[model samples]
Target: MKIPKIIHQIWSGIDGPLPQEFRSLGETWKRDYPDWEYRLWDNKKMVEFVKNEYPEYWFVYQKYPFNVQRWDAIRYLILEKIGGMYVDFDYESLQPMCEILENKTCCFSLEKEVGSNLFKVFNNAMMMSTPNHPFMQKIVKFVFSRTTLIPQYTNKNLTIFNTTGPYALIRLYETLTTEEKEDVYLIPAQFVSPFTGLEAEEVRLGVVNQKLDDCLDNAYAVHYYVSNWVKTNN
Candidate 1:
């Protein structure tokens, strides 16, 4: 089956109103993918979703120590149940998603090394798949399995990454059977990512040497690395 034409984005709304610039970044997705369905989820909607569609995982979802972990978990469940695409708000759309996806039914954006992240190669920042895809099935299953396991990282970000972020996704993805890996595409970094987390910060700080336009010639989107998960205040 082909991937659905929908986009899912979430915000906790804990930081007062969603920032105007964030909305502008998201508007790029809307403008580029005019026909795609758009779904913006908040903390309450996310909680209600779990209580409704994934009641079995409610305890685990609530038990997550970090809000970012819950953010990571919901993307998987959203794609598993709703299918389509989950694009982080920081990922600015440069072109229509369909054109960039190139007819793939399932695709995960790949990133270059991310500091100390073990699974930096496969980023969940932008993901596309049909609903009920086999890979996503295993994704949610793996998420549930980690509910009781504790990663021993001293840094909170590392802990979240290891447990429910890209680390967990790639770890589970690698263990899938050959048949289960079928139709799952690992997209190259330059196509969508185009920068490491450090490099992204440089871009954000406006200190990068290379002209931004020079690097994005082939990019369909650019992840600004807003990284709300890294902030504790919220």
Candidate 2:
């Protein structure tokens, strides 16, 4: 049987370094769930989409924007155009993402509390779905729609973006139905990310047992935060 394919998007400029990322992803898949496939999507599509859809917003990307809100919007727009999950280059997939978000229209890491400024702030680092998912479409469109007006208020760079918390909360609130909103799974702050210094133990546990069947066996991916791949045997 052919393994199901999962999509991963990155910038076109990183083509040379893509091999290392592919190797990392491949190793994790082989070690954990060998029956999965990963596909790469680059910045070309996003660039075109941004130009055609929101020409005035093009310069923002040139400034090297780090805001998750805007990045997440681009990711979902691209995902909607093609179909599948979009992951950040810095992320390492310890397991197939589908394992965690199975049958769900869309899923992204979530912060535990409202005031947390941690990584779960923006769903940008990782996002999952098949295609044309209603909620995901709504959230992406809302973010993109606001892009045109962003420059009117602030310059190309804004601190509001470095933390995706407030925007994510608002996006979730806007897109989900009352029940979906209330019952949406946060995927346990640790399962999704270990952004706090206090979460070191949790990351150690994941590193110690980097297998699909171990630590949050139901999780689909592991972010690892670090850009390079390394493993220490326990």
lDDT of 1 by residue, 46-77 (tens): 99999999999988888877878888889999
Candidate whose lDDT is highest = 1
Q: Pick the candidate with the highest TM-score.
A: 1
What clash pairs does model 1 have? Answer: none
lDDT of each structure? 0.82, 0.51
Q: TM-scores of all models?
A: 0.90, 0.59
Candidate 2 achieves a global lDDT of: 0.51
Candidate 1 stretches with Cα past 4 Å from truth are 113-120, 146-151, 208-211
Tell me the spans in candidate 2 whose CA falls farther than 4 Å from its real position: 1-4, 14-37, 48-71, 97-99, 112-122, 146-148, 152-175, 182-185, 194-220, 226-234
lDDT of 2 by residue, 50-70 (tens): 788657656654443443344
Error of 2 at 102 (Å): 2.8
Residue 62 lDDT in model 2? 42
